[model samples]
Target: MAEEEEEKGGSKKKLFMIIGGVVALAAGGFFFMGGGEDEVMAEEMVEPEVVEGEVLDVGTMTIVLADDDPDKLRYVRVGLALVLDITADSSLVAGRVSLVQDAAITVISEMTSGELRGAVGAADARERLSTAAREIYPDGEVIRVVLTEMILQ
Candidate 1:
């Protein structure tokens, strides 16, 4: 009976040691793998503070334009419609109604049919429109510029 008791005690000691080793290895691997470094660095990179005057109340706007020629006017209307739909649905212009309207008009006026279809043309248009809107309304920040429509017939 005494021998049996000693054997059980030894087994328990072995089990405990195995569990402890596994835990230590897991902890060591976690630290050695640099798993937490990214999180630490991300937390350290803070956003810059915005002074009170620098902040702007951005808004969205809509505009409609038509050419004198019937065919051209129809194309313009289609383009305008596309622009409106895109701008209205845009997540970036959710609260900026005035900016969206101004941007749509500015983009449409500046765009040629070829430019509208070319590679990187839409991006250029968005950038130009956003810049123009910002200049027009310096008090309002334009977060995004969307192309809702392009119709040139």
Candidate 2:
């Protein structure tokens, strides 16, 4: 009976130590990742954007997916928006919406379902679209490309 009680006590101590270690590690991680004053300091130290930016809704587009196997037909419908550097006149980017749309359709329609399914593929698509749009306006930069809606069928 005594040995059994000792065994139980040892196990309880081990459990407590394990719990304490986990708590300590979690607390350390939280503090390390800007959980306290570090977060406020980090935010305060960052600089703000110099150039104003604006979002342009590119709207929805449906592209027939390039499929390796012809037996199945697939399509992707995505809603895209562009963040562009703000200018005095809206025509800077607004005037080129048609060009952006044409570039997007031309690029996205060429990708197979397998090429557009994962996170990497999505990022690649964004980069390609951005490049295509930039090609339209060689002097201007598209700040960011947003894929608001992505439906794969």
Candidate 3:
């Protein structure tokens, strides 16, 4: 009976050693793989600052869009403004305002009424106008394209 008791005690020690080893390995893995890397990365992330710039009015435009109905017509009237750096040369845009207006008209006139419906549509139009303006102006000349007023019908 003493030998039986010793054997049971020995088995308990082995079982405890195995559990301890597993716990140690799990702790080691967590420290090695899941350490403060995510926290460090989060700390390094930064948001861009919004810079206030000068506004240049590109004037209002009324564009006619082609519709499916032969007798009906669709149109959009949009007022635009261009944001430029404070020190940017206004003459560059003012001298070529007509060209910018033409580009705006071309872009807005191509879209159907449905494409210009929601906030997403307005954002898309703004992006397209910005791209078009960039093509006409040098880099950094036009900082952003602003839609002062937009009416889709």
lDDT of 2 by residue, 46-70 (tens): 9767474777898999988888778
Cα TM-score per model? 0.35, 0.62, 0.64
What are the per-residue Cα lDDT tens digits for candidate 1 across 1-153?
A: 999999999999999999999999999999888788888898899755432222232333333344444455323332211122221333443455555455566666555555555547666766676566556435443433455554445
- Residue-pair clashes per candidate, as listed? 16, 0, 0
Among all windows of 10 consecutive residues in model 2, the one with the lowest summed lDDT is: 85-94
Best by lDDT: 3
Tens-place lDDT per residue, model 3, 1-153, is 999999999999999999999999999998888788888988789654546477999899899875577677898899999988666788766888898899998898888888888999899999999998878887567877899998987
Supply the TM-score for candidate 1.
0.35
Q: Model 2 segments beyond 4 Å from truth?
A: 1-52
